[model samples]
Target: MSIPLAERIRPKSLDEIVGQSHLMGEGKPLRRIIESGTIPNLIFYGPSGVGKTTIARFIAENANMTMYKLNGTSASVADIKQIIAETEMIGGMNGILLYLDEIQYLNKKQQQSLLEYIENGKITLISSTTENPYFYVYNAIISRSTVFEFKPVTPEQISPAIKRAFDLMAQDIGTEVMLEEGVVEHIARGCGGDVRKSINTVELCVLSAENGAKGELLVKMDTVRELTQRSNMRYDREGDEHYDILSALQKSIRGSDENAAIHYAARLIEAGDIISLCRRLLVIASEDVGLAYPMAVVITKSCVDSALQLGLPEARIPLAEAVIMLATSPKSNSAYMAMNNALEDVKNNGPLDFPRHLQNKHFDGADAKVRGQHYLYPHDYPDHWVKQQYLPDALKDRVYYEYGENKTEQAAKAYWAKVKGDKNG
Candidate 1:
């Protein structure tokens, strides 16, 4: 069988490559490197289907260099050595540009083996990975290579690419397929900047319509949505699914939906979003649970720290625990509102000067001036309650934290009320 449309139409030159104008545009760093004929050992880090491999090929072609491509997922250390040996044989004639895709999958040992060759300029190494290299790649290997981050193809770019692909296909088949208006835009949005997936979905729609004897292919929004849902896994790191999952997580916590929260947490963890999952849980504990269940915040923090230290699989346990704790805790937005209200007061009224009597007096003769002044130490008073103006003068009577009715906060409120009455009486 012939190659797929996406592969068959792969850009052979820089001019043919889509998107990535930031790097391929005139006077760009990558453009300069290619023009100078002195490409450095570099790592292309970014979201998938954004022309990482295509850009690498453009650079290799422009420089008139031989390209040696390898998938780090399937290749072993022995495979790397063999490629290197072959490159060295032709080293004196024309240099070889080694393109290692998914380089983050390489273990430390294999990564270490590539370091010498990269640094010594034996191979102009160009590696592409969808992961953050600092976390996944060996530090030694990272230090040896210049890193270029590629952004996902934006909707503006994807629209034109889809049109170009569709137009080309129509010309080849000798049939005019009228793409429904705004259909390309919908597909672009659904793809979340994944160019390959967008193009493939368009091809699928066209093929389906052709078989059905439809002269005009109406690629509806629903069709695009269904294609995205069916073909793509729903939790990509840099895709819309990431944001969707995050939103679900926050809503689940806010609504006190423990089951839903845990489900969202599982989805994030499965998609390798451990850090985001832990961070959101920590925020939920403090902002949503707060003093209503103070232990929730403590547990969440402990989980975050432990997850960072322990890393994956094992780390997932602590994250799961924190998610459960945050979800099940007494739900309250008191602390979140309190901070917001306090910040609003500050922004509107400006910084309030500290009361002269309450100001720090470390200098000589300053203590006497401050002593026996307006300041009242709440701890020293009966019931530990002295209702001095804690808020600034502009917000003196403003109340932000509405204590929740949970057992823990109710008790705290009662204790504070007794202390306030006793000290004032």
Candidate 2:
């Protein structure tokens, strides 16, 4: 029932803030902006527990504006209207700031609703989001606001905050609180630059420790390890960590490291990101495994089906099997590269015309020879293969797909060469 340690030690002033010296430090742009007493609509972009909301609160307090808070997830258009109405009642918005948390949760329609209010100076908006605001926030809102990126709080910055939490706890409980050697460092390093998490972890450890004879709580290293567990894996599906995990998984599979692939797959599974894993697996099967192992596509597709149907812990079985198959399969990016090269040409050239013989046959008399329909069927040839102009005139001699070192691709190259020779003869 007591206030959380994070809330109790929340920095009331910029000096009390432990990290983000880049912006909160002396003579920084943000510090100067605050001192000028002219707060603009702003965006604070960063990861969770990195003080995005705290900074917004600091701005509201320092600016001395009548501030209203809205959470983008639960608050609706009605809420915005209510805030506007309330602001109007309180002397028509001479100085007002609306602090919106998780602003990326609002859809374009909801974000668009704020433009008029923002333009008319009914309220100065301060928005916080874990996502890159440029991608998730409406462009209009982005254009009107100054964006400040908040980085992860370092271990040194968090250590002092952790010690402060202990001091506050001791004062509250009327007893001395002590930590075993290295426990603080363990937490500071393991928290991964999250001050709020470090504080909560220390609080949990303190609460779990047994009281001493003189009524002191002693948190030992084992208690710290037990309560804190291992280092928390930071993941936000809409944030940078999502792409990082995907990249790690793909590289592991491409490098034929089955163990690493499975490890990232497990991370995704634990994060409830099975769909992204399935999507990336399908791409890997076709892009990396290509003609070197055509069956890889079939295997991965089956795994995807099984995963979607089975789901969760049971689904991990097929997902893991597919990961191993893709990792162990011979790698080739020929198909992926070939398509990209061809697409680049198409995009740059603005859609070249197709060959006359290859044009779509839709008219009633489309097969007439006079209509340029003298196309030879491959079935009429010796090996059921024939050479014809399949590419446009400009790219007739262009070679998009190059054979890889795999036996299957080598055999394909040989078959194509033989077909060309027969046609020449």
Q: Which has the greatest lDDT?
A: 2
RMSD of candidate 1 to the true fold? 10.1
List CA RMSD, all candidates: 10.1, 7.0
Q: Go through the candidates in order and give the clash count of each.
A: 0, 0
For model 1, the superposed segments whose C-alpha errors exceed 4 Å read 12-16, 90-92, 210-222, 234-298, 301-425
TM-score to native of every candidate shown: 0.62, 0.66
Across residues 208-229, which tens digit of lDDT does each residue of candidate 1 receive? 6532355655555566667765
* lDDT (Cα atoms) of all candidates against the true structure: 0.77, 0.84
The sequence of per-residue lDDT tens digits that candidate 2 reaches over residues 35-91 is 787889999987678887777777777778878889988989989888888765755
lDDT of 2 at 363: 48
